[model samples]
Target: MGLEEEIQELEDEIADTPYNKSTEAHIGRLKSKLAEKKEKLEQQQSGSGGGGGYGVEKHGDATVALVGFPSVGKSTLLNALTNAESETGSYEFTTLDVYPGMLKHKGANIQILDVPGLIEGAAGGRGGGKEVLSVVRTADLIVFMVSVFEIDQYDRLREELYKNKIRLDTEPPRVNIRKKAKDGLTVNSSVDLDLDEETVKSVLREHGYVNADVTIGEQVDLDRLIDGVMDNREYVPSIVAVNKADLIEPDYLPTVESELEERDIDPEEAIFISAEEEKGLDGLTERIWDELGLIRIYMDKPGRGVDYEEPLILREGDTVDDACRKLGGSFDERFRFARVTGPSAKHDEQQVGRDHELADEDVLRIVARK
Candidate 1:
């Protein structure tokens, strides 16, 4: 009989099991056989054809790219993140070619691209600026690296991106300060200033709060700014890495944090890590993984003659039905049932229905009639 006919017969047998004790063991045996068939079907499907082992094309996995001005430690961070031997140096444009590496976290592998350092006027075809930013645009996430020691570094980088029309959500607003903090007036204490609403709006606009309405003494929402940066790309998330933390003085950390806050970026999302020292690398990796919403699940079938060592990485919302659909329409129609063998399984081996949700490291054994 065909796979479909076999599944139908098993279903009928299961329905009649309670009615007849003579076929109870037979029904159980059918269930086991069906599970084995499904496992083989899925294994064949997974190995069909794909660039990255998941039977999908390139860019199927979430991609994160490192971007920043020259000599900003982008290459160093890439090396630290992936343990890949990417060239790093204090000289500008040390990395002329884009290097791709996979960083595995919690079974999910994230493809990270390290692009060449960008300079001012990069978008205008100057200093290979536009070409570099174009590459950055394709990235799902952009890690903007900056050196704290450089005077007005943030402003300079923003100006370069603006001149090139390289869109960055965190550009600060421009304002002429006619009123300074009064002598002996501390920042903690409030002082009256002759500033109009338009002036305040213009200032806020330069600080990356374009089209924002504001009032004097009113607090600005930083979370909204972070959301704006995230909205720069569709469905892709971004994270900030505050590199050279070891070089900067401890007292300067708060000021840097406040500046980022003013630009609408959260201090928490901006990780402070020394790529050279490998300090806080774990935290950075975890943050990136969390933001990407990726996970890995493995199917272990010892006697199934399939590779169980490598796990499948999937998005957070992926389901068993979704996976089957990815295989092909026929597989979905022929899907009889599924069984899982892993730490999360209810029993040593349990039958799973069509609507079953898969967890990380789940060793699934699917049963198909054929």
Candidate 2:
């Protein structure tokens, strides 16, 4: 049988199997096979040009994908938030191509993409599934734009993204697998794992690792372990922007917010806005800024203090070496240290090295080899 047929058979087996201690190992092995088959199918699709992936070059300090179903005011939101000329209409799939826009906020240029609308079966390569989601995988954040009346679409959208290997609002699993030349597969866990050792070994064996060492540092389920084994998954941060809020009644806002809340979605982070009326856009921009978690590091000169204008934009938790590399060419390799001031520095101008982590609003002065 073909890879697709094998994948379907494995999926059917996994669905038919009852979940308990007895069948857990069998189910895990089936899932591993299923994942491998799907990966092979993806490879075939790529080779045959069946999945013509989107090719929008990443720009600005960060990229945010405006994703939703058709006629959800994504184009309008794109135009309202940035200087993009994406066509807007009151019909489905108005934005056919990925339109790029630059939103300048808090001294940072954030690139927002308005891609073609998604639909049901998008995860199965329908409605430009691979193309649209490929762009999403490249995004630093995904702003799910849903209409006020179609609030339930959030769940469907998330489901499709999840199926596409885009783990929204989730961190990477803290599981590690090491292959050894000898000894059977040994499983070690720092925390309580939902899957037993037999199940883990079965999954590992299905993935072509007959002998290996597995370390589970976090409380993980079977699916999480499989995700750790498969290295192609992308974890992205996400937020929601309920568009066309002006059409809804003022009293109805609470119901919408409550719906998102009941689903464990943070209502406080969800922005209610009308793209046509250009309402609540500042709040949306602020939310995007905070979600990106960016930091600014000002460059300091000896005896001249910090150059507050044109600060180096860096992500949170970036080190001094990262900052040096951003400056380009041999800076990181230069034989010298740096002087730091601000929250990260103990004193006014403390001497630091490449490994020093930088904080927001910090001032850095590098003294390279003479």
Candidate 3:
């Protein structure tokens, strides 16, 4: 009958079916069909255009979204970390719109978004969840904020993002496909595959691939295979911040630490902060910088010394060519060579080319053509 009912039926069947070698192909086909149904339903829903999306324009070197349930101190955290005066309140849904702030850390301007708190049924488009989740999909990183009193909210937050097709902290599966004419579906893999070729073909056919050459580089389960076939997912890195640490009693610290461990997040690694008191903001900023994989490169401008006070920010593993491209204008077209002196260089002021990989705090001098 209806697409929603059809999707639920497919989901129920896949869940009810047993998993084994004999039933693997069946389950895979069911999963493919379910994914197709979900995709179609999502398209229909998007076309209906119910919610008013946020007017959040990505800015600065990178953007991070503050995601959590209501009254998790996201606004307080945003105010403490950046210049944005986000309204902080003790009640739920305090932030009705997306408030953007800029944090100047390590010579990088990082854009921080304090959006409305994500409720439990966000993936189902409840409470303007679709609009909020849409803003999050564009962020470079997601800072999962939860109160020390509500550490369990972390799982629900991640689950909402997952249902919205926002995959965190993982690379896209290396599944490549090339369409052909009249040769039929063929699957190839260097590693041993868990799914039989039939299952792969079923997924391809569900996505309307009749004759194609498919290559899967690694072993993937049904979900990963589906993700590979569907290219609309967003892969992002995330950091967990347990806010309002000052409210927790000393005796309950171990219990708090235990909860984080249960979530597979090291208590030491997770940033524990009292956002209202401005405590642990330093640690949070440091984690943001590290997780963003940013590095500072001091440019050696001619007729002037190296500018270390305002170093150019670049992502790690970036090369001299990348630096040139970032500089924009004539730097890219008139480039000749470059000299580097710092962590990335073999020696001080070593002559380097466009392919030279720059490290943090590297002093770079581009010898462009006159």
Q: Best-fitting candidate, measured by lDDT?
A: 3
Name the TM-score of candidate 3. Answer: 0.97
**TM-score per candidate, chains pooled:** 0.57, 0.94, 0.97
lDDT of 1 by residue, 86-146 (tens): 8989777788767777787765567777767566555334454545555565655666666
Residue-level lDDT tens digits of model 3 in 1-370? 9998998898899889889988887888888888888888877877787555578888899999999888989999899889999998877788888899999998899999997857746767756778888899999899999889889999898888998899999999889999998889999998899888988888888788999999999999988988999888999999999998999889999999999999999998899999989999999999999999999999999999999898998999999999998899899989888999999999998999899999999999999888
The TM-score of candidate 1 is 0.57
Q: Enumerate clash totals for all models, in the order shown.
A: 11, 0, 0
lDDT of 2 at 336: 96
Best of the candidates, TM-score: 3
Model 1, position 292, has a per-residue lDDT of: 65
For model 1 the local lDDT of residue 6 reads 70
- Per-residue lDDT of candidate 2, residues 218-297 (tens digit): 98788889998886789999999999999988899889888888778787878889999999999999889889988889
- Cα RMSD for candidates in order: 26.3, 1.9, 1.4
Candidates arranged by lDDT, highest first: 3, 2, 1
